[model samples]
Target: MPRKLLILIADGMGDYPAQELDGRTPLQAARTPNMDAAAAQGTVGTCRTIPSGMPAGSDIANMAIMGYAPKRYHTGRGPIEAAAQGLDCAPSDLIYRLNLCTVSELSPSGLMLDHSGGHIQNEEALNLLQVLRTELDTDQVQIIPGFQYRHLLKHTDGVGTLEAGLDLVPPHDILNTPLAPALEVYARSPLLDSMIHRAHSILTSAWNQTQANAIWPWGQGPPLALPSFAHTFGLRGAVISAVDLIKGLGRAAGMDVLDVPGATGLVDTNYQGKVQAALNFLEHGDFVFVHLEGPDECGHAGDLDCKIQAIERFDEHIVGPVMLDLARMEGAVCMACDHLTPVGVRTHTTEPVPFCFLDSRQIQSGAHEGFSEAAAAAGDVHLEAGHLLLPYLLDRMQEADG
Candidate 1:
């Protein structure tokens, strides 16, 4: 008879005012009747998920949102993604995010053209990763394939606690920037440096056919361990996300990581499938954390219309349906973004993003009319740190056992 909870995360849903939209953020402009209804009947406010001066990557931000202090638990995005791919790593293994990127050159330093390499398909990406493995992988290294442009490269015996401190930069953060400065970090390790150079040679030859000419390695870290969600929060939890990082978070938290067919983690992802997955998990789980990556993808692409469309689609296909299903259950619901991925910057911001939570049995009045950056800013109930918000959210639930 424990109270149930639903946590919905629209990745990078927060944004700044758009000049073309008359100063309205995408969420402010989207037709989110369902989210609006939740905001109007719930407690809404802003919360800073990413700690100050952090990389602002989804890995760090989401760790905070999931109630694990990023400062303590976060090793790097690479290790989390490795966990999601079910890749076993020793404590001394150096894990990196191997993105199939487009570069202008294959020299020691080149211009990073596209982090996603036109959002290459999974089949093609896998093929390219295999080629990399053949050309680069040795007894000391392993190349693992993941969805779309995301992949992994692991260097065994290269990431002891001391070696894990490599200051690598995420390729997405340096779009249109030179790669030399970033590549210099690997120079410390002769093997890794040579691998990058050789990988470039192999990629340059295949550029004409693949559009992906290079593998950008970043987010290096050693193996990691996290406290289980059940142990920390006293709830059996499940997580639904198309992205490996979120799935990794779920696995680290000892939550059920569900895989929904047709989930692409893009603007055209399987929204309905995710909603259904959430429903299925919530049927027996004490908590369900649902995450969608479409809005964040569009924001990173700087496509205003697509971002708005993604937000609208999330409302119609995911939020609306889940809310309807939750209506018949005795549970509480909460919705929020992990961090702000402003379309202008085309990257994650450390600003405080907004959130809204409501009790199913007693809907509070005087709540904001809708969920948006502006609306949440005006409302009360701000949490200074994002990790604290989850516990606060659970405290609002109406107890069925009572």
Candidate 2:
């Protein structure tokens, strides 16, 4: 029988040493008995998910973790989410990830108060998006609503007026910073700049809520295409994630994208539902990729206590239950983070993230005490190419059979 594969991704769980934690990272400081046990029983190592010179965003990192080389397959964050929404686009059309964010003002000197608009709920965000769609939906531009504060802007660009070199920065990277630099970049495309200003006016004057007053568009690209997961790995695969970017990648790769109710990409997400969905998918699927976004969200907020709680909850709610279920099966399991979203920096870094792989049929004792950056670095295994991680786990399963 072919061995099964389970890959659990705790998004942005890795971190740099925090002064608040007495020089220990959030992972090291968190209470993660399940992760610690896995590291102690399996092989722990580090993998660099983001390619050199690429932006350290979740889109690139998760793509690398899903066994695709981001340098070759990545287009932009927007196109991936577009795939999640099942949007059709012409080759020349542009798609951007539009965020309903909180800006102190509309001027260049304004500050980005909250990238997620105070973690706006789905209903409120949808209402705001609908208003924008009604007013701003032109022949060339369309407003697409997504979960929470995440949304999309599809530009047909039929006239080819937008420059190919137009670049915009992600809102999350500029938290609590002056938005002038990003606004300057936005000015590169007059259409986009004007739409953003108009969106601000519409959102603030129309809605009583001051949380999400502006629309920030960035991460533009054409539609993305990927090789089928079954064709590449010879296994039926599924992906469970609340984030559209991950779901979009799964859709583009022809993998099953499982959606669990109440699985918000936040600390209050439904953790038990995700585990149940993963287990259900594994009943017939040969591979299942489960991703949790709580830790990453906390990291982006720079909330140390919440980040630690998110990591602990991940271990208790997601990792512990799934590991117990897979223990009786003939398969291998891997737990890892895509990239380091250090609370100190409050942004993603292109650092090698720690990972642990275990073969249920032939488990081996590992030298590490737990799963953390320092401990994984001290171990013997390291993958300079993150895309090779899936293959490495499969190879280990094959070796166990031999």
**Which clashing pairs does model 2 show?**
none
The models' CA-based lDDT, in order, is: 0.83, 0.88
Candidate 1 local lDDT, 1-402, one digit each (tens): 435788888899899999999989999999999899999888889888988778788999888988988888888888999989878888878888888888888554567777887788988888788778887888887888888999888878876544467787787787767777777777876776788778878877735377888787789887668998999999998889889999998997889999999888887888888877777777787888889898898888888999999889888987788778775777778888888888988888888998888777767675678889888899888888879988887766634344
Model 1, which residues run further than 4 Å from truth?
A: 106-110, 161-163, 206-208, 398-402
Candidate 2: C-alpha lDDT: 0.88
Error of 1 at 279 (Å): 1.2
- Model 1 quality (TM-score): 0.95
Cα distance off (Å), candidate 1, residue 186: 3.4
